[model samples]
Target: MNCRKVQYYLSTFSEGSFSSDKLSEVEVHIRNCKSCEREKFILEEILVAVRSLPTKTTPDDFNLKLFNRIYAEQNNPSESYLPTPESSWIRRPIGWVSALATVAVAALITMVFLQRPVGSPDLPLNSPAYSQVESTSPVSTPSGKHVGNRIPVSAYENIIGVSGSASNYRATNVSQVRTLRLADARVESLYVEMMRRLGAEPYPNMLRADTRYYEMRSPFARTGSNGSPLLRNAASTISY
Candidate 1:
């Protein structure tokens, strides 16, 4: 990109927001071009200066004036407060430009520096999402080999007694747990309790209360890395 184009988009780039793909292109241009690099440096220095300046209180009638201005402009499309001769504004720096730039610098500093990135989608404890990753077999690697899951379900979470071979077999997932429903009345009661504890609603939704249908349909739910049953030992009497 040329110096003019680089400088044109520099303000947006500096604010740390732009089209995602423009990142490397802009960075490459800015690093190679001395003039653009210097401009960026000067812009940063100005932002620092603006940050150090004390803030002034707005005029008491600022909002009223702004509303009136906007209303008048809306009524008359030709009428605008922006300078008609923007070329001069671009080529020549004036007092008004200095004030606006100061404001812009301050606003940009707040938006870019102080603003926090959004937190990622989390699988918090006891959430259905947490169960999707938990109580399952180890994740398979690229070479079709298994390393035991480093972030396995917390032992303290369920605290249920496990038969010696339960880990090697038995319900490995929500479907497996769901499959256990109506296998016996006592097991169904226990399943309902487990689902409720895992943030599932009770009652009419009891049969598949805690489980997303998609999870039940997922290939991962079908089998384990080892030959362990993933929802195997199906009950012949599925009342649901």
Candidate 2:
């Protein structure tokens, strides 16, 4: 038998569990091979030492301690599987990011509301001003000519047709008035465009002069003539 085969059967031989034929073969190998004989002797010495050592007995409360540990784990599983320090540190930054995002959203909403103009509504083209002008009583000129209230005439109209000097002056005044109206219109358009882009309401001062004129003619005018306290309060609120 080879040394490997002898060693393989060595434990069975020590226990008297090997067949007689295999035992005889292992003994022959160990007797002839010095390495096998030395290994056999060492194994026998180890086995003897192991058998000579005292066997340790479990404590009477060992089962109780194990049962208590299992019960505690079942009662509070989270305590047993608590997050590590590194994981907690990583989560803290995420919480801070969420808080910051919430604060930023709130601030943006507040800013939008602050920028919004109060009580601003879209103005109609055929508003009350045009209607008022159409409904006004007609005025008659000195030459028995009746003119519509909607037509704006120059104060120098009589002289405008009579002399070149008056005509040029009238033309210059009309041009200046047209230029001023055009400039105001341009400014109003720009202000409206800016309000639209910002999602904000238009300011009261940005309204056209005709619109303001008609608004003043409303029954709710701030002159305190209508004897309405509500109108007076509303006018006071919007005066600035």
Candidate 3:
């Protein structure tokens, strides 16, 4: 009923495409709006001219030539006129630059790894390399596996991402570790019992897993916390 809708349907209205009620709505809008009325008049004139123009047939050889070109491409791929995918990718400046950069980074990583001449890889943390670590206390993990608290200095790198000697790293500093193992075990048991009141075991994953254990190791931190909790853990870890 609006001028916009009337102008949009003017061609269809000229062709008598709408039902009686819709036709009446469009006609009413065009008659009341002078702008829409002018649009309708121009549209009618164009349609009349189009209907009066002569129609021409396409060339009979057009389809045959198209088919022949497709057949030739199939039989002789190198002779095809179309641009190839591999050539097109290399032709674009951005694509070739990206490819070159990726290859350079890969080669750099391979050379660094192959040429490494630093200290030997360290033992696992639980191994007995922590000098003066006179005792070890076994702590239970969430999955019921036991791990030792005698973390050796050489267990991990002095600088995690750096490639060099372990002299600064192999110096021992850890002295003690305390954990609420009994409390966590008791809490897990209580939770299982409570959820089982529904006459079913708590779906395997619903029980508490991670338990609190704090280690007293220090020599100075390698990273800063920046006051964020996530960065706090990584940044707070102190070692030789």
Candidate 4:
């Protein structure tokens, strides 16, 4: 065996488990190679030093004391509980200032909203006069139910209209819209099958009944087909 192979087995040999053939190889290499012999001597010294380390001995009451301490921690808890010093009064002012800043931001937002003129033309995106509706009416009514019987959502005070004369004008009503029941599972399945026949993957999670009501306002986009930009159709959870 080469010196490298013998060196590889040298550790195993030191542990007293090398095969006779491997040991012979190691012995021959150590005798013939000074470098291998030096390495062997170093390994022996390391093993001896490691074995000579002072062994830790437990006192007769070690287990009792350890268990008692643990029990005391569990029962009393004072030993483990470190009380942090109360923050310095000077430092507290900064925290108060930060809290005031956050509150001020919130107040500013509320004031901006409240100060906004009702019926003013400015409307934000996704501003679907949802405040007009109170809650989604989950009742099962017969077809052709009276419109007044339906729950009323918040209404839009501001009405957007075309710039020209009344007859030449168009208007977008920002109002909460009721979700369409058309996306029912059966209808969705039919749509998926139709798409499959056309060799297109059905939209991901397409079968789920998801609906959203978009803002009723003139599209911010300058260029689009006539005044009506298609509203985003997606599910909207009305927050009370």
Q: Find the candidate with the highest TM-score and give its number.
A: 4
TM-score of 2: 0.25
TM-score of every candidate: 0.24, 0.25, 0.25, 0.28
Q: Over the stretch 1-240, how does candidate 4's per-residue lDDT look in tens digits?
A: 777877787798889897787678788788999888888889999999999999999765454344434434533444666443533433788768755764565465445546655442233333333222222443222343233433321122211111111111123122211111111111223333433444344333222211121112223223344532232221121100
Q: Which residue pairs come into collision in candidate 4?
A: 131-154, 132-153, 132-154, 132-155, 133-153, 133-154, 211-234, 211-235, 212-234, 212-235
Tens digit of lDDT per residue, candidate 3, span 1-240? Answer: 778788888888999989999999998888888999899889889988999899997665444344445445643666877876655666689888866765565465445545643322222234232212223454334566444453332322221112111111223113211112222222333333333343333323222111111111111222333322322242222110
Clashes of 4: 10
lDDT of 4: 0.40
| Residue 212 error, candidate 2, Å | 97
- Tell me each candidate's RMSD, in Å, in order: 28.3, 37.0, 23.3, 22.6
- For residue 1, give model 3's deviation from the true position in Å: 5.9
For the record, the alpha-carbon RMSD of candidate 1 to the native fold, in angstroms, is 28.3
10 residues in a row with least lDDT, candidate 3: 208-217
Ranking by TM-score: 4, 2, 3, 1
In model 1, what is the error at residue 71, expressed in angstroms?
A: 29
Query: Which lDDT tens digits does candidate 1 get at residues 55-145?
Result: 9987654543444454355335457756455325546668577657645644653454234332112223454434443445544434554
For model 3, the local distance difference test gives 0.42
Clash pairs (backbone) in predicted model 2: none
What's the true lDDT of residue 215 in model 4?
A: 18
